[model samples]
Target: MRSLTVVGPSRVEWREAPSPELQEDTDVLVRPIASATCDLDRRLVLGDSPFKPPYALGHEAVGEVVATGDAPCGLRPGDRVVIPWHISCGTCAECGRSMPGACRSVHRLASYGNTAGGHWGGLFDELVRVPWGARNLVALPPDVDPVVAAFCSDSLVDAYRTVSPPLAAQPGATVLVVGGTASLGLLTVLSAVALAATEVFYVDRNPRSVQTAARLGATAMLITSYSEPVSGVFDLTVDASADTEGLRRALKSTRPGGTCVSRSVYFTEPALPYLDLYASGVTLVTGPPHATPHMPEVLRLLSSGALDPRPVLAGPYSYDEAPEVLRDPPPGKPAFAHPRAGAA
Candidate 1:
């Protein structure tokens, strides 16, 4: 099997790897129908992230089951499924409480692509071994367009997980979104609108993303000058921008007694305005999204056609072109479909 390997900064290549076998009766093998570069993958590939190289390079993929072990899983050989980015034992204490991202059975960070995550080999592989298949695989409707549906493995649902809670608490609240490099920023803008924010304001430096935000129903602005205070104005604010300056602006934008959620993972410590944050009595949320907990709600929204991720689709790259596309994943998150997956 061929696996996409990231050798170093801006260098990606294909390497022959042994096909994964079913080590347990519960094991299953899946061939990815569609996959895309995730936010963390984009940051590490395009910039200086702490992750080292020579590792299999992707974690977001929607796949077709090709083989199943003798154990009876509700799934069969032809079912399509979303492979979660993090590994979890559905029976564990933390997992039972909906904290699979911090599952105790495996290393706290165990996942497919990154080295810190037990190096389970990325979803970019031709064949992926899924342990505890029944627990891990989330079956999709047969009619799903794998290209738009691919992000269920990570970002798309994560976007919903970020905005849902705050909006649920205060329906029709005004929202301010600070966006930067990751596709999550754009998706969050879309999610906020779908969740019925009374007003949505998006601030980003990227012209392309700002335009996309407009099409998705948000009032978009390209971040130019933050000389004036933009804080204490919005009921809820999301900071997906990896930039420090943007994060502070987002935090400041939250109204007194409102909420601000940040989804960026940064290596260097960002300087924060503690006094201002303290004075506002604002609620701040920042951490790994427990994606599984919100899957049902997000999947329902997508399947119902209430939300559309198609506008953010950049490409359906040929399987062979995956390495290059992923090296610097496009502004709109790029999706990859194997020719065998029936790409139109």
Candidate 2:
């Protein structure tokens, strides 16, 4: 088996590694049929991430279950499933509360690409070991394309979780997505539109990203200057860009009693205007997305053929080209496809 390893900043290579096996009765072995790069991965490659190198470097994947343990409820060998980025023991207290991403029993931040939660390896490998299969894996419907479903492991699911709950809390709310033309920002735009926000405003300087947002039903605006006052009209704002300006804009964009959600994983010290936020009476929320809880609803939307992630999929590459693809993503979601392999 080969896995994509990030040796250092702007350095990535494919290394032959031992294939993963089912180490526990609840574990399942999967062959990645399709895998995509997360926007955060670009930051990791540029040495902008807090996570160090010499580890597997992918987290989003859709794959075929090659083998499963005897204990199972909905999955089987040959079933196409979406693997969540985080490795969680579903029976933990946090997982029981429908917050598997914050499960205390599992290693904190136990993700496939990072070493934070123990090295479970990355999805950019030929084989992956999924622990707690019954609770974490979401079987993709036959009709959904593996390329589109690949994002369900992270971005799509994250988008769904970010928008749906907050929107449900406040129907017909105006939402603002503060970020660049990156995948996370774009997905946030799409999610806002899909959830039927009264108005979806995307802030970014890149014309390409702004164009992408416009095509996806968002009012794209170029951020020429940070000093300009953010139009404080939104009920909810999602800051996928973890920069200081992005955060400030998100806080300022929301109404006095509005909520702001930060989805970006910031590795640096983001200078925040605490006094301004306090004065505005803003409610700030930020965390890793609970993808396990949102996967079902995301899949349902994909199955219904109402949601199209193709706009977000910038490119699709061969499995052998994983190293180069991560180094320089073409544009949007760069998905790796294996023709011989089953749908991921």
Residue-level lDDT of model 2, residues 216-293, one tens digit each, is 999888777555666657899988875778787788777888888888787767887788788888898988888888
For every candidate in turn, the CA RMSD to the true structure comes to 1.9, 1.6
lDDT winner among the candidates?
Answer: 2
Writing each residue's lDDT as its tens digit, candidate 1 over 15-115 gives 99898998889888998878887678876665477778878878788888999989999888878888888888777998898888888888977888787
The parts of candidate 1 lying over 4 Å away from their true place are 225-228
Cα TM-score per model: 0.95, 0.95
Query: At residue 160, what lDDT does model 1 achieve?
Result: 87
Cα displacement (angstroms), candidate 1, residue 311, comes to 1.0
Poorest lDDT segment (10 consecutive residues) of candidate 1? 223-232
Error of 2 at 282 (Å): 1.2
